[model samples]
Target: MAKYEAKMKETESSVIEFIETVENPKKREDAYKLLEIFSEATGYEAKMWGPSIIGFGSYHYKYASGHEGDAPLVGFSPRKAKISLYFATGDTEREVILERFGKHTSAKACVYINKVADIDVEVLKELINRSIKFLQETYGS
Candidate 1:
């Protein structure tokens, strides 16, 4: 089999510039606020992942099938419709926190909220720390 390549690799793009390009005023503001929250929670500087995501910290993982790649430990993107939160999946603590996270929808890999105010910031911080811990335990940083 050919080697697999991850599409969402980190880039040198300016995160502030990317946030400035967000067309939605509310989403743009939320992006800045999330930047602050994620930084304070993870204690890692924000980085631009691919073109759209504002990420903090990173880790490498290899699946059972040998698919391996580096990804941000925690991140968020202020998309057109909703802010997509990226966190480690399959974490039970994350699932538990989501119950009290307020109005939001979740997918297999991401949590979607209309805005930062829609969710409990404390829960969000817990989720961020939990994700970082889970990833560091599962895959060394």
Candidate 2:
């Protein structure tokens, strides 16, 4: 059987240069701030994942279907529409925090924010910590 693969793989692409390409000045600035936040929170240097995401730390995951690969413990993408904050989905605490996370929207895998000022930084830090802790406990560091 063919090997299963993860689409969002880490790469050697320059994270700073990629952030510099963000056309919106505000998004660019937010990207830098997020970079710092995730870095300090994860205690890991950021790396480019796929084409856009800035990821900190990594863990390998294997599923029952035999799909397995390495992925960032936590990450984010500063897209044109909004900033996508990556976290472990299905976390009850994450859900609870999002309810009070100021102005933001969330999906199964990410929380979207228009800007850093739109959400609470302390909550963001908590989300980051929770994500890293969850992934580490679930998949090891």
Candidate 3:
């Protein structure tokens, strides 16, 4: 059987150059802040995922049906509307942190925020730590 794959694979693309292309100046600045935060929290050098996402660490995941692929443990994309924070989707601690995360919207796996200043940095750190821990526990580095 053919192996499963993810479209959002890591790339050698320059993250700085990608951030530089963000039309919004504030989003560009926030992208840099997120890069620093995710890098410091995960202790992983950032890499570009696909064309836009700035990913930190990565892990392999296989489902019961055997579909599997590598994915970033934590990452973010500075979109025009909001910053999409990629985190452990089902983590209860993540939900708790998000409650206090300050002015953000969340979906199944992505948290949307307008700016870093719109959220609490300490809570953001906690979320990043929790996501790294959860992902590492679920899928080893």
Candidate 4:
């Protein structure tokens, strides 16, 4: 296994346990579905990131600020308040997509949506695929 995969498997128990305690079946289901979508979209297997995120692919990165680390290429965690989506890269079309995303808030590189039901799934899928493509083109092994 890849090093990260081993780490993920080693931590799988904690990850699954936290998902069980999240107390929202629908949110949990949405997270699982998002994993499925990302997997198909990226052709990369999903790995548990810590005890919450379901991460797809992997990459090594260094910031201009001197912070550097290896992490999942893209990921998402279904938090109690919202679904947090992480993209290591930025998309210029983000604003256009956000206008169509229904209800969401975004920081520098993450997008938070209250729930899957609150947005258009088709648009979500499009944005997700676009983000994955952007990453692959910009930073691929």
The C-alpha stretches of model 3 lying farther than 4 A from their native spots are: 1-4
Ranking by lDDT: 1, 2, 3, 4
Ranked by TM-score, the better of candidates 3 and 4 is 3
Predict model 4's lDDT versus the native.
0.72
Can you tell me which runs of candidate 2 are displaced by over 4 Å? none
**Collision pairs in model 1:** none
For residue 125, model 3's alpha carbon misses the true position, in angstroms, by: 0.7
Steric clash pairs (candidate 2): none
In model 2, which range of ten residues has the least summed lDDT?
A: 1-10
TM-score of each prediction: 0.97, 0.95, 0.94, 0.76
The window of 10 residues in a row where model 4 has the poorest summed lDDT is: 2-11
In the range 65-139, model 2's lDDT, one tens digit per residue, is 867888888999999899999998667788987877899988899899999999889989999998888888888
Say which candidate scores most in lDDT: 1
Number of backbone collisions per candidate: 0, 0, 0, 0
Per-residue accuracy of model 4 over 1-141 as CA lDDT, tens digit each: 433333332134454465567678888878767767777877887777777777777776666885556667777888888889887556787667778888888888788987777877777777767776676676676
- What's the lDDT of the predicted structure labeled candidate 3? 0.89
Once model 1 is optimally superposed onto the true structure by TM-score, how far is the C-alpha of residue 39 displaced, in angstroms? 0.5
lDDT of 1: 0.93
Local accuracy by lDDT, each model: 0.93, 0.90, 0.89, 0.72
